[model samples]
Target: MTAPGNQAVTMNSQGTAMSAGPQPAASAGSLRSALRLWRLLRVRDAGRSDPQRLTGVLAVVAFAVTTAVLLLVLGGFGAFQQRAEAGGPYSDEGFYVVLAGTASVLLLVPLITLGGAAARLSMARRDERLAALRLAGATTSQVSVMTVLDATVQALAGAFIGTAGVFALIPLVLPVTFQNRPFTYAELVPEWWVFALTVTGVALVSMLSAGASLRKVAITPLGVAARHTPNPLHWSRVVPLVLFAACFAVLVHYGLAGIVVLVAVLAGGFALLNLLGPWVMSLVGRLSARRARSVGTLIAARRIIDDPRGAWRSVGGVALCTFIAGLTAAAAMFDSVGSDDPIVADLSTGGLLTLTIAGLLAAVSTGVMQAGGIIDQRTQYRALHLAGTDLTVMHAARLRQTAIPLLAAVLIATAAALVFMLPALGFGLLSSVPLLIQFLLSVVAVCLLVLAGNLASARVVRTVLA
Candidate 1:
């Protein structure tokens, strides 16, 4: 922010901007400048409401979950790679290593999504802070730096907590054996540089996510006041997914020709599901809103239609995990192959592990997202509560919001997994009793995990409304 015409702006050492009549502004884009601005803003927010404080707390917890899971996933990958290269009699020829890599790849999307969500958790508060900084004669660069710095500090705090969490988690994992050998803490821990890298990566992710939001919000005070409707999701979002599906079918028709192409297509197809998710969610919301016969469903559908991107973010992890579970749910059919190889048995273990962790990630991420949503809409909720509407209806609405998209996402993902795998595994596997049991258990566990995540926010809802 700069002086225009006769007005003046200056800051005391305490960081409060003063009407000191024309004076020089603080240097912009410096770390010191950003910290000073942060302090000034923090002071202004010192008297924040409980809901505001809880929002910050929830964001930090989300960051901690993200960091801890990241460390575990990377550590697990390193352990398998190290064990696979040891040239021992216990080696299954890098089989477990491949499984670990698959799990890591599958977990990366949700982990990063959680990180971004945590960074931008306090959206409404942040916009006000940004506007306040601009009013305080801070430049855009200074405001941007402060935003990133604020997110980085929170992530750093969470990273430390997450590091401590890893130690506790290692003991729990120690009891579970892979290849008849339980993991020592030493085996599960990554190298020191791994921790350093994880911290740096998290900071970078937070910064980038913050930066992206900065672009969306204008820096001017009036800009903050302006309300712009979110643009409707374009049909272009579905083009890539449709094309990918077409290519997949073409290959499937040719008796699965071009094995390398098949592998690439399969990987690309899974990626497209994520691309297609929000669009499908928006479509679901639009349709459901029209057909909604009850207040709960109507409100839930409207919320999704309002922010389909967010709607997907809350449940997207489960949708993807559900997709993975759908494919692996039929793993029991492999046991009937009657092979002497221990590798066959390990498949079930690996699938269960992947589904379990995925569920946990989805649960925590959903909880954090829902808590944040409650804080964001606290104003509306309070108004409604005062108007004699029951909070139970609101709670039911939120549950529907999560449940409906979850059903759509699961259906889309399951159909995709079945179609892709059907060429190789055939319809016979779907009919196998053991396969049905394992897959059903996997799906139920994930749904239960996500339901648990959604429920985690119920406490937050109560707090906000109260």
Candidate 2:
């Protein structure tokens, strides 16, 4: 209100000052500070939009509910010991250790892989930024360390959290008083050396996982032009395909017997998802176009099918984790009925039920991510709207794309179970209350995952369309 002349003069002076100054240095410094702050913020936001966190929480809860699972594993070992003392048929300490050791190793590897995989995925998403650092004269080692630090920190945090949970639950899981017999809590505590080794292992795993993504950053073309472009994974297809073929062949040759076959199957499944997901998506995309009755439905379907490989590895890994947990639970139920030991039977059944439920919750993360990806592709849906497509039909089509792969995964898990456990526990799988509960719970889990994914996607679309 004072004077238009004064305002004009002030604006001109500021414009001239900004133009005349050495601006690049200031701009670069400001950007560097901002980027640093953003990374710190991201590190702090661990598990905020994460599926792994959800899964871990559910796993811990399962552990809490089925304290008998822990007791049973230990008790089973003790039973083996007692039988050996009495010269019973199932009295082999070496056998118990072999079984327990194998299970423990299987559990440890995937968990370690999870730490690395999460880091790699995050780094992949931020590849452009990393490439910039490389172009700015950053050494490969420096860039790798900087990019992987976030993952290392997260892995350390997870390890600490897990260790804390164990310590906290020890007393609750193993009570001091049982039938008036005083028990020492020291026995319940995890050995200090073992706990220390575990934390170290977790940290190392996280670092290694994050380190894997550095190859893309260090090797990719760098500089200003690299900004805002998709990071190229030159051999992503070939390497994964080869691994998939090799692993699958090994697994099949092994005939799905014992833990070795199980491990092979898992590795093969992961590789296959990585290799074949893109091809599946392409096929789905083509089919969707041919089946399109309405414009919106066609577009949504095509969009989902076109990117099947986009998040396939993550989804596959999540599905694999759930499958293993579910199978373990189902096996425990079988053990419950067949075992001569009453305590083993009771604990196995309880653990089986709890783990099955927990596995479902863990799977929700991947489902949510799939839904999120569809929501992000809103421009395609909007274009369909312009072409006179129905929104509801489009939404349903998107959901169908997600459901197809999950259905396949479920079938594979079921088949693995039939082949592996059926021979050991005859007729247990046919009619068992625990198995029924586990299957029902898995269904509930999948429904919940779908609902979550849909809701998340819908919310994204609404916001963008608005």
Candidate 3:
């Protein structure tokens, strides 16, 4: 009986030990998860603490807010269209509202591009920290998650602020009349779900862009340590331009069915331009490289040839603005052919406002991107400075880099606009002084704004080197 009792005691002790061992393992896992969360929070806190990183966040936020505001305005125009279709006072000219709404939607292109630029800028600033994180045993996936989290946070904050901005703008927008009628706040304000969707969309875009930008660093952790040269652009990019031309020819021969077709063509043309713009820059760079007489010009040309996409990203908004100006000018000329319809006047005003917003956003994006490039290349800049290279030469190279692509964008956009418009507006429209003045002024204003923005980044270079 004593032996049997000892055996039972031994069995119970073994069972208890096994149960206690599993509990500690479970506790260890939970602790690990908690620690990960803590580390993520710390990483985010560190980003916030750095001024350059914080600026990047702010830029993302500002872009998000701007996008949200534009979306809200689009919703308002949509609402106006619906009301007009319901036999509101401007029922005869309801299509104007629709056109305006379409223009507003198209404006999203620049906003999206601006957001992307800001995200890339942010990531560029964080490259070293990300490399450090990788060296410290953080997995690639973990670093990516952290980047997405940072972007999502900034986007969410921007969305919230943008929502508030919409509300704030309501009073200001109320006084502005379209077709001589005021817009009620209810008509201008979007539904809560729309705002929710806007926030979600912005967050998703930001996260995706941030993640995409990290692909290089994620693949080769060492890639973050140095910049890699981009691959040469192929000739295939010309396909879009050819396709657009063919489509435009067909549309013109048959005549556009309605405003819808016109809008579709315009939008499609712009999309093709987006694809072709970089390729064109590449060609320009190559040609400039061949003829480059000075070191600054050669450096600028080579830089653009190497990364035409980057160069285009900085000036793409200006190109879009140029297109808008051309279209608006042609419309103004067409409207002048007859009586100055209040609806036409209103449409012109809306177009001008859209162009202005686009130009401003372009300026901001250019400044942000330029500043980011300066930050990313600070070491190289310092080395160059130490090697007796005049900083002024570098500045000149940057200016030339910007100017060449910019000139190409403006010329292409203007030519495309005239091609599309001349078919509908007739050649007589070209002689309209008011139309010419408006168009030229729009181009000049946008150019000045872009230059100013680029100049602003020069101070950033000085600060970084200091």
> How many residue pairs clash in all the candidates, one count each?
2, 1, 0
Q: On a 0 to 100 scale, what is the lDDT of residue 105 in model 2?
A: 34
Q: Write candidate 2's Cα lDDT for 1-466 as tens digits.
A: 3221111110122222111211232244434533453455344334333322332232233222223223323333343344446553443434443444434333333343234333333443445444554454444444554555655555556566666665555554344232123224554454456566666765565566556656766665343234343443333565665565455445556665455655555455554544555555455556667887865546555555545555343244334444554555665675655666533543354344334333433343444454334333445557766877666766676566555555544554455445444554555666877776766575556545544544545544444344
Top of the candidates by lDDT = 1
lDDT of each: 0.75, 0.46, 0.72
lDDT of 3 by residue, 274-379 (tens): 8888888999999999999998899889888878998998899998999889877866765676855777777676787778778988888787777777776677
Best by TM-score: 1
- What lDDT score is found at residue 357 in candidate 2? 34
RMSD, candidate 2, Å = 10.3
| Tens digit per residue, CA lDDT, model 1, 1-466 | 3363122334587657654333333443244555765777666554435455676677789888888888988888888888999868768788788777777877887897798789878866687656665565555555666677677778888888887788777776777667767777888898899999888888787777777667655334556645355788887988998777777777778776464565465457767877888889999999999999988899899999998989988887887787677656666467567866666666666667777788888888888888888887777778878988787888899899999988887888778777777776678866777777767777777878888889878887777766
Residue 124 CA displacement from its true place in model 3, Å: 3.0
The deviation in Å at residue 107 for candidate 1 is 1.1
Q: How many angstroms is residue 290 displaced in model 3 relative to the true structure, after the best TM-score fit?
A: 3.6
